[model samples]
Target: MPHRPNTPCRHPGCANLVPYGQQYCETHKLLHPEALRSAGSRGYGSRWQRESKAYLRAHPLCAECARQGKYTKATVVDHIKPHRGDPALFWDRANWQPLCKPCHDKKTWNEDKNPVYSY
Candidate 1:
């Protein structure tokens, strides 16, 4: 069997190569601590499941889709502002919003790709 080729580290401007299927080289991997945490560790445990489900029940329509004049069913309860492991933000009902999977995915993608730096 042939060995897989190493791939470049995902961190910007990093020249180190890492094993296939690995996202970043050793030096850069530690920079993304969130990637090491499981969904439960990130606060999406049973309690979150229960609360998010109830939130979806109360807000069935996707907020984004509603804005666009569509009636999409919401499958996700997203944080209007990312919780980032902050318990206060995580449990805040006022910061929550209903979003369909597509809208949720798009929003998450954009947020991750272009993070807002708070100085």
Candidate 2:
């Protein structure tokens, strides 16, 4: 088998090489930190949800819950901090997490007590 040359990332000004057909290098492939805040308002609602579902399906263990050995199926992408007051963090993948239904419900209930809106 012959080795193939890596292609440069397609994202503008990105110098890193990536596999063919990929628009960004590994680091830039995900949404930018600040971009997440307005990503929902920028018309990424259902599309983002689909993406989140796919991500969870591919990695079924809830990031946090799994750390604690909780093996429940992850069904929600939760913001580490409420996106309402900090809209800029909305689209940030680092700010998002895969959570099981029970964990999500608990988080929601906790949020309800604080009452912050992201939408």
Compare the candidates by TM-score and give the number of the best one. 1
Using lDDT as the measure, the top candidate is 1
Give the alpha carbon lDDT tens digit for every residue of 13-68 in model 1.
78899999888788977776677788999999999999999999999999999999
lDDT of each: 0.91, 0.70
In angstroms, give how far residue 31 of model 1 lies from its true place.
Answer: 2.0
- Count of backbone clashes, every candidate in sequence: 0, 3
* Per-residue lDDT over 31-114 for candidate 2, one digit per residue giving the tens place of the 0 to 100 score: 333333466665458977787877777777777687887677788888877665444786677788888878888987787445
Instruction: Report how far residue 60 has shifted in candidate 2, in Å.
Output: 1.3
User: What TM-scores do the predictions have?
Assistant: 0.86, 0.52
Give Cα distance to truth, residue 15, candidate 2, Å. 59
Shift in Å, residue 43, candidate 2: 6.2
